[model samples]
Target: MDAATLLARLATVIDAHDWAGLPDLLHRDFTCRLVHTGEVFDRDGWVRLNADYPGFQRMHVEGLVADGDHGALRARVIGTSETGAELEFAVASFATVRDGLLAELVEVWADVGQDAPAGTRPQLT
Candidate 1:
């Protein structure tokens, strides 16, 4: 599959929570980096992390773009915490593909509802 198709399929597979399908879409040397947490994971580790994530409800792809072997995606993830709090997160992912499979992925994630920094800007009326 081309980069765009591969990325689209990836979004679909993730949203469907098809952990078993992740391996098929990833290269043998696949690696994932979590920018916010400063963590790195190989294919097996990444798959296990996602599969065992706490309160993973679903993910929605907000935007996606690809150029040749590189792709980027913006996604909204929803879940309920162990404390019964509803949670939402915004995630940005950059990916590189090799031989039609995802080879490297770097992701940054943040809570969706955080306010701007105290002195960054005045609130609009």
Candidate 2:
């Protein structure tokens, strides 16, 4: 598969929580690292992390770019935490594709901050 095709299919797998289908798209030695958390995971570990995420969530892809053997994705996730608090975050990931499959992924993510209240902005002259 081409870079774009691989990324789109990967998103599909994630949204569907289709763990079994992951191996078809991920290389045997695939690895992923979360930059903010300083954590690195192998293919199985990465799958397990998502599979075990704390609550119901949806990942929305906002943008994607692919060139040659690399791709990047920008996304937002909205979810309700186990504690019943609403949560939102943004994520960006860079991926390496080889042999028509994803060989590596490095991600950076952040909790989406709330805007100031309606009246917070200062009046301008």
Candidate 3:
């Protein structure tokens, strides 16, 4: 799969909350780094976290760019917590593809502040 196709599939998985289908797009030794928390996670760790969190109500990709073997995407995620409070976050994701699958992912995200809308600018900071 090319970078665009892989990223598009990733968006679909997150939108549908289909954790079971994630492995199909990942390498066996895939690794992800959470920029904010400085946490490094393996493939299994990614699956577990996604399973624990309630799925997002909506995710809008604001920008996407793909190079030969690299891709970058910025999106806005909107969801409601268990307490029914609305939440919004801007997420910037970078990926390196190898052998047609995602081998590494680095994600940087932040909660949208009061001044921002649910889907605003890309959060690269």
Clashes of each: 0, 0, 0
| Residue pairs with backbone atoms closer than 3 Å in model 2 (clashes) | none
**lDDT tens digits by residue: candidate 2, 1-125:** 87778887887788777878877888899999999989999989988888888874678889999997899988888789778999998989899998988999999998899777789899889
Choose the strongest candidate by lDDT.
1
Error of 3 at 29 (Å): 0.9
For model 1, what is the C-alpha lDDT against the true structure? 0.92
Which candidate achieves the best TM-score against the true structure? 1
lDDT of 3: 0.86
Q: Mind giving the per-residue lDDT tens digits that candidate 1 earns over 1-125?
A: 76788888988888899999989999999999999889999999999998899999889999999999999999999999999999999999999999989999999999998988898997689
Q: For residues 40-77, could you state the per-residue lDDT of candidate 3 as single tens digits?
A: 88988987776676846877888889997799988899
